[model samples]
Target: MLAVKLPSKETIKVVEEPIPIPAKGEVLIKMKASALCRSDLHRYHGKVLFDETEEEANITPGHEPCGVVEKLGEGVTKVKKGDRVAIYLGLGCGICPDCLRGDVMLCKDFQCIGFQKNGAHADYMTIPEENCLLLPEKMDFITGALSTDVGGTLYTACKRLNLNGTQTAVIIGCGPMGSGGILMAKGFGAKVIAIDLDNKRLELAKELGADYLINPKEEDVLVKIKGITHNTGCDGAIVTAGGSTPLNIALNAIKKRGSVALIAESNKAQIDPSNQFIRTLNTLMGCWYFNRSDWEEIANFIVNHNIQLNKISSDTFSISEAEKAFPLFDSGKTQKVVFTWD
Candidate 1:
């Protein structure tokens, strides 16, 4: 089997490794497609630390993945061989308080597939049965791969904000997660605003049904949003960008008593208490990994065609080309980049 490994920052190597054998209650998947996400870039640049030794030891790098079950280990009965599936990268201890309460992402023993364990940026990977979700018969691999992370993130954000038709929403970044947030907000019938520094991404948001697109470089985001909402401002805002500037923009654009969902990964961010208090920001929700409910809802949305995952995928790369894929993603030139074994 072949796998893409990160030996250190800005370095990727494709190495041949022995095929993995699934343990009890686990299954081996022959990967068809896997998306390279911003989180992967964070891991690559040594920004989001999973293990201090990850930088020194070679580790597989991927999470958003879709595949077909090639083999099943003892005690695995939920999915059979040849079943098309999407791997839920986050693995939680099922008996933990958080998992028992159905909030698996909050499990104290949480171990993510691509981060703490072996991931899908390879020809084959092994995952626990609880972490695999069967894909619809007609769903393609690319979209299925993305549903594991990006789609689930949007679902979590929407649920946290309690988005509805009467509310006005804004997504502070127009990357994959931000774009997914826009689509989800539109589905809820909320007036949606997509903000980004890149005009191209903003345009993509408009195509995805965003009512307003604001590039902070060209226009005052707060003023434009206020003008659009009749001086009321957005009812809810999701800060999907990790940087400080986008976070501040979200804070400024949100209406009083509005919710601000922070879905992006950042090492450090500063917020002024006065600004938060004056705006009456209702919540600052953290959306890192998805719970089982979030994954199921996202799966339903994809099956019902409420969200278009294919359109948001900007590029695809082969597993052997992992070295090239990381740099392209870092360059900010693509939206969703998938690495395929097929």
Candidate 2:
């Protein structure tokens, strides 16, 4: 089997290794497609941290994955050989209190698949059977791979906001996750506005049903959003960029007492507490991985063609071309890039 391994910062090496065998209650999958995400870039640049105690040689870095089950270990009965599935990246210890509450991402022993363990950038990978979600018969590998991250993250953000039909929503950044938020908000019957510096991404947001698109570099984002909402401002804003600008924009654009759902990966930021307090902002929520219910909902929505995963996915690379995918994504020339084994 061949896998892309990050031996160190800014280094990716392709190496041949023996295919892994599934342990008890696990499944072995032959990967079909996996996506390169901005988070992967963070890991590549050494912006994202990993446990130093863990063996770095064992680390594999592609997490947004879809594959076919090749075998199942003992006690695994939910899926069988040949099942098409999307592997959940968060590998939570099932015995934790948080896991018991169905919030596996919050588990004390939580470890993400691509970050802490060997992931799907390989021809074959192994995962606990419970982490795999069965894909619909017609779901293609590319779409399924995107659902593992882009679609799932958007779903989780929307879930955090508890969006209802009457709310007005704005999404900052218009990358794959931000664009996904536009579709998710629209599906929930909210008036959606998308903000991005890139005209191409802003145009794509319009195609995905954003009622308005704001280019912050050209227009005053807060003013435009306020004007669109009849000066009331958006009921909620999802900040999908980690930079200080998008966070401030989201804070300024949201309605008083509204929520700000942040899905962007950030380490630190300069924030104004006074402004947040004056607005009586209900909360600033951080949404990362999806729960089991969120996974099921997103899968069903994609299967029914409600939220079009196929349209959001823009580029494809083979496993050998993984290096090129990151640069293309960083250039903002593509929306979502998937690497395939076939």
**How many backbone clashes does every candidate have?**
0, 0
Residue-level lDDT of model 2, residues 248-283, one tens digit each, is: 888877778888998887778888878774556457
For model 1 the local lDDT of residue 94 reads 89
Ten residues in sequence with the least summed lDDT for candidate 2: 49-58
Worst 10 residues of 1 by lDDT: 48-57
Model 2 segments more than 4 A misplaced: 52-54, 278-281
**What's the residue-level lDDT of 146 in candidate 2?**
84
Q: What does candidate 1 score on TM?
A: 0.94
- Steric clash pairs (candidate 2): none
